[model samples]
Target: MSPAQPSAELLEAAQRPFPDAKAMPPSVYTSTAFLAREIETIFSKEWMCVGRSSSLAQPGDYLTYELAGQPVMVLRDQAGALRAFSNVCLHRMSTLIEGTGNKRAIVCPYHAWTYGLDGRLRGAPFMTATTGFCKDDYVLPSIRCEEWLGWIYITLDRERPSVSTTLAPVADMVSDYGMENYVECFRETHVWDTNWKVLAENFMESYHLPVCHADTVGGHSKLSEMECPPGLAAFNYHWITKEASLPIGNAHPSNTRLEGRWRKTTALLALYPSHLITLTPGYFWYLSLHPKGTGQVAMIFGGGLSPEFMADPRADEYVATLKTLLDDVNVEDRGCTEKVFRGLNAATARAGHLSYLERPIYDFMHYLADRTTGFDRSFALAAE
Candidate 1:
């Protein structure tokens, strides 16, 4: 199908009952025009998870991201408050900073315009002589930013629901985990050769684990043990209980909060548009994804130890073990999703039936249909 072809058939199929649902059309995964529509209607309007609040522990710590093609920066100001602003320099429009790091002020590499951590312009060399050019006239445009359960989120849409409100059910579901107390140990970014949704759907379900992740996490996952439930409005989630492959995946001896199954169970959450999380009793890891056209995805991948594990004497070894396991799992996911994207390009390709295990993907299709096609279907629970 051409990139601009409408996905009416796929949208129609999404409304069917779970037992009859099918995978979304291949065109939806390979369409640049569809991706552009999603950027405007969904990504631009929703709260996007950037990283853990714990990642920015000090004043001057900052990170940059591109949201719906807009450059944005999130940082800790001198007053110890978290703030998000347009990363573009007000003077020449050059991006104020790159990647992640700490600095006393944001300096424009293009010309030397400098802004304080509060995003107030402080210096601009040789521009003072220009007509009415006052540094006081400029301040970086602020973006809506908030922290909930220790995760930092930013949105371009000022009127969107607050993260806390939208994700309250999720917070309640994992309440005993005390997510806010988790400490980030590392974060990294990577670009993958697959459609963003392909990767997201992969994360949302475990049916593929025994096959795709056989070398890493597969041996630890049993499909029959996975719980695929109906999703809520802002997200879709499922659960699984198994002996953790990593010792840290289970509760620490010090943790008294989680009872029986929860100590061994993991919650896999797919937060709409694109944040995916795997929360275990002793650790958490996530992927915050942004699309690069229809065929590639830019991902911020990070994870950390839960408070109980962080306080353990073996914290350093646990961190290393978690990182290594996550790295291996990511490699398997990259290969699997890339192949799916390639298959999507074939002339004979068509979507087939969705397994009960892929219920999250079914909900995700309804979400896309709602935004892109003006479909009136509602995924919200009466109360969550």
Candidate 2:
């Protein structure tokens, strides 16, 4: 469990077959070096989920994020295209925008430099005096951004495959859910006092639900009813079938797209590198994680409803109820994940064996090893 050997230990655990697989070494969660390696090999190269595409429905609608220390902006352009660009201003290197809002133009707060919705430099005050300055010469550099099944994903690495290609398994698995039509109702961001992977691993499995979420989402959860199949190369997933604790967690009465067990089924998806989604029949919510060093994680949390529920007469009531339920769920998760981090940092902390219910965590460990240590392991798990 020495910090110096975390990657090697992680690789060994990641290569172990299921049922005999042990938990990752504690140092993997507490080591700064391991985290730095992940930032380079994982976050920099992976397709990161930003939020729902519906959140940027109008021209100039924008949201900003810091991806692996690089500021990025995703916005809807005047031409009705979803675009991603470097948020740093071209002239003075100041951030061109702040927070989420609809902007007529991207204007730098430090100077009067302005860019159009398409990122073309449009104006600069008193810049005529600058030698060899041409307004047309400056344009914010673009980053790769794509929309797959209603989610917006961006990446800094151009060599990475398209989000659609990488996450096709997820799309096909949830095809019946019509995830693209699920509208986003809200989005929020928070920084939690835990390693990003700790929060991610917590979200990847439901074994802790009975204890960690006893006051909120755990009441109706039956561990035996949850399915933890092996994960695909791009993501890991599990299923739960039950009578939903909330009405909207099941299909809305008007929904005709789902049949039989699917009407009451929910899919918990961990899209690698750090996008976790809980997609129910009538609603969906997700978390996009970014590490702030090894001790804190920045999270983008959001959720929304399917078309059937959105069109229902009690749509407003359903939204309110869903929001409150999610808030409660987050409170429980934060407490649980933070406690795990504290334990991970302890001198006596050690990894234990993984239960059958923690298959996703096992798959995730492989992903971490694959990225950080260049451990070549096949992750194309067949569906059971």
Candidate 3:
């Protein structure tokens, strides 16, 4: 049978052209069936950033993530190569690991089935007695994993292009930041009470900044000063150039390649499917999204000073102050998005017209439309 589809209103919104476009319909945010389609069609096929490779610099370091319906874990093998594998054990389907940590081997807690960091089966305490059983035949399923600019990405679909290929446009724009050298110093994981789309849309435009972030980062740059250009196949970015009034918002110590107003510029990006980042000359921050369901999203946030800032004596003070500022920003965003989630369910709910400043949002909707419906312009899906 053909898979279910998003609502007609939503499919229409997804295909709407920019400037004349409206926000996505409420059903898109609240429909469980549409969420299932997105999970299988979009999230399952995208090469999404999970975390920093530096966390796995040593052999045996591992971290866990739930991608779509799969329980996945990425680890460093004895040769220091990164590998991603199903975290489920072959024996009785038990989850092999609980959380992030260092381990010499993955041992299933239920039956003690052991596997190497490379995902090869090494042992099964009682499986030898089973007729025709062999450790070599029971390797943990593996997925495609790659690293780019310090971030580790994994795609359940092996046919997906290299993450670098998908991110090339963004890579060019962010190359001057020396991003691969910036180590992760602060990290946070949380499940927000909102749709993943709500959080992602919140970051796609600066329209709400003046009202939503008045006390923090709102007024630093006016909406007119921001630039939202078209994005490539896999991602989109907007430019924000402004001087800071916050303690850690000053020009970065390195002051290397950025010239003119760009010295104080920042790039906020949305990597289709669900990766968001804010890259600045002095520091960087990211929010990696995973939808738990229609109403919840798993958010992974990480930030640190730039490589140049890390070498300065004020690095400690700057990072500490930046962390606080980010925390405040998070608090405000959480409240705003959660309320928006509830508002999406209102009987009076309907999509509003898009603002000119929300160009990235329009691009994101196009990316979603193309992937979910297999057409760049619009999808006219019929009932199966």
Candidate 4:
């Protein structure tokens, strides 16, 4: 079947100049048609962040991810190479795995069909009873998978650019942060009761820090401290300079090259489609968002210390305190984003003017418009 396309009106809206922009129309988030189109045009084709490569530590270690309702898994084969496969058994299309763990071989829970970690079909009990049955032709279908800086990203589309090529701008800007060697020390996954785009937009801006995060990190947010740069090929970023608030804020010493408040500065980066990251000198945290439907989003939230911090004897203490602070902040942000989703659905909800402080939010909206409409309209903020 041919892939679906978004509505012409949506494409027209994307080309509107920034000064004329209001928040996107409600239908973009609440409509069934739009969701289906997005699944076809965006989710299936994008190089999406699933989790960290470190999550699979050994051969046969595996983790599952879903894109547009199709389940797929990432694993290390006997060759120690990372690979991705459809999580459904070829026999009856039953989901093959529920979660992450080490497996000697992948055995389907239902019909006992088995597959090698490399995705080749190994055996299928009783299948020989059927004429013309060929186990050799029944390998689990593979998805495109790649690892960049400890993160594992996968895509259903075979023709797109590699993840590194697509996101090289983000890599260039944060190259000083040493992400390649940074291991994930803490991770949490949850399904939030909000539209996926809402949480993604929430992550790209600090405009609400004072009101939404009043008691947590708000005090550190000064409008002057943020520098919102224009969007580039694969991503957009704004820099925030604030002293460390979590106990582990400085638990690890800063790189000698980054002196002064640059050590405390955090680069808030959003890779197009939906990967958001906070790159700080000492530690990093991220949110990878995916739509569960029009009304819910699955969030993979995680953090880890820089190598310097990980090497510190006091790393454990700092991590404990940092987690607590983030936990509180997350509670605050959840409340705020869920409210926004509810507001978007209301009769009173309407697009609003963009604030310079919310520049990253502006960039993100442009990105969504471009993807949905098949045009690149990412340029120029409304006059300052």
Candidate 5:
């Protein structure tokens, strides 16, 4: 079947509660059954960002990742074409690639069976003469892969809708930003000891900026300065905050280009279910949140923008300031989320409420609800 596209009516339904004032039930964050359903229905079927295209800059370059518990390998073939496949060996079901690296061909470590970059079986020792064995019938299963704004994305269900059709609004947003030319500067991994949903909820709203990130990020950007751009696409908010103070030392003068008091921070272009692309003043950061279980999540953050900003005299200073801000926010957020986890764990707490300012969080929940239950006839019906 062809991929599903967001219809104008569906989009309109998604935007119905535009400036939403309602709060979401706490179960949305703490339920294990909900997480399982999300893994099965949402993550498996959606277009999720895995890594940047630059990671596979040359032929034979590859990266191994797991999404919704399914191991996947993203690689460029000998012909330099990008592709994605289940990272499992067809013969013994062993993982083909352990981690990210460059390889001419993938050889299952359990057995010597080898597969080419295109995921076609290149050789299977001792299997050719086996009774009822057909090499032609055994090739690594392929997954749907797509690229956008230098990022690589994949979907587990081949029968699901195409990535482009599912994310047309996101494409339009990227085009508006001239993202093709935006360069990456730095990418790092962050692991949070809480449910992935908790982290996502924290990121979806700006209500905590004033109290939680006051030291570094709050000093720079005001809570009221944030803006939520319209559309159903995930992670589509924008904020322009002012720098508390100028550079303290002469460590790097190149960053003076961004010496102004105000700093623009986009919530990050989220493709849905997992990938998050955050664009700062001089750099872009992409994060893929892989859920391990009810309370554990592997957050892979990687990506770097161009080095032109670094070449400037104060570039290092600017980068340092931004890094400090992010570090402070992460620390603060992790602490609060950990506390939230404990709160949700309490048997006494039955339900929690979302604030009116946290509309983005509700939007996300509504989207998940629509996708999982299919009870909201408005979305699917509107698309008609």
Candidate 6:
């Protein structure tokens, strides 16, 4: 069935209650069964962020990464179009690319078989003419790929919902913010020793800002002053702060750049299933989470803003400023999330429910639970 027709029962299930946010259950973060189910039902069918258009800026440029235990490659073809394919070779199931680089063609080191940028089998050095081998049947399998604001996303399930449908609300929001012209300045990755959900939960709420980020983000804006909007996916928290409020001496050295700007506000937007976009002055950054296992997650961060902003002479002066802000924020979060993950695994605490103040996070959990349980039912019932 179509994405627009998600079952009413599933929607209701998503809107149901869990425990409080502070007292979340251990199973949600540590259960192997839950993780496996998430991999199959959520990650496999979702539009997962893989890389950026800038990563494959030129034809023949390629980057390889894994999602849900499946090796995937993002590359630009000879025609300058972006494409994605399973990194596994059709011949013996060996991975095609070990890492990121530019290549004229993809050649499997296992047997020297080569494939073109378009995923068409190009050469088989060992095959004999009498083998009657046909290249048409041996092309590398392709995955569904789509791009928005220079970010690349891929899906393994061919029958899954379209990217446009899954991300319609997000597209509208970013467009309203004029993000299409945003240019990227930096991209970084952090691997945390925690369930992916832990990171997502932390992002969904601003309750910890005054305590955890007091030295960095706290100096710029007051947590109590931020505006929290209603609706789970429709609105996220936003805060505007003046640069003069930044603490130059006592604050984390990483965010020292905020000292110069007249004013800047960091607008945090959390899209369901692991997509986060943050808008700061002259730049925008995003983090996409990929679960490695029940206890680990890989966070890939990318930045973009109007290209014009990067070209401005004044923008150069703010380089150190932006670096410090992101560094402190990420480092602090990494430490806290790792600790939270350990706490969830401690076996003494029970699963927590969402508080009224954390309605957005509750909404996200509801959405996840609904999708996980209702998808199969909806599909089956529709078939009948």
RMSD of each: 2.0, 1.9, 3.5, 2.9, 6.2, 7.0
TM-score of each: 0.97, 0.97, 0.94, 0.93, 0.81, 0.82
Better structure of 3 and 6 per TM-score: 3
Each prediction's whole-model lDDT (CA): 0.90, 0.90, 0.83, 0.80, 0.65, 0.68
Candidate 3 vs candidate 4: the lDDT winner is: 3
Candidate 1 lDDT by residue in tens digits, 1-384: 443465676566766777878899887887777888889898999999999988898999999999999999999999999999999999868988999999999999999999999999999999867998888999999999999999999999999989999999999999998888988899999999999999999999899999999999999899999999988878999999989878898999889999999999999999898999999999999999999988999999999999888988999999999999999999999999999999999989988999999999988888888888876555432222
Q: In model 2, which runs have C-alpha deviations exceeding 4 angstroms?
A: 1-4, 379-384
After superposition, candidate 6 runs with Cα above 4 Å error: 1-23, 232-265, 351-356, 375-384
lDDT measured at residue 46 in model 3 versus the true structure, 0 to 100 = 88
lDDT by residue for model 5 (171-240), tens: 6654534454554445566677887877776766778777777775556556666675433744445444
Candidate 6, which ten residues in sequence have the lowest lDDT sum? 246-255
Model 1: lDDT equals 0.90
> What's the lDDT for candidate 3?
0.83
At residue 115, give the lDDT of candidate 2.
94
Minimal lDDT window, size 10, model 3? 375-384
Candidate 5 lands at a TM-score of: 0.81
TM-score of 4: 0.93
Model 4, 1-384: lDDT tens per residue?
112333554555555565565566666777778887788878989999988888888999998889877899999999999999999998899999877889989999998888999888999988778999998988888899999988999999999999988878777777767777776888888889999888888888888888899999888788787898767757888988777676455425545646666677788888878888887777788899889988899988888877887787887876777677778988998999899889988988776766777767666766776676656553434432
The all-Cα superposition gives candidate 2 an RMSD in Å to the true structure of 1.9
Predicted candidate 6 versus true structure: per-residue lDDT over 279-333, tens digit per residue: 6545666789989888999888776444445555656555556666778888888
For residue 362, give model 6's deviation from the true position in Å.
0.8
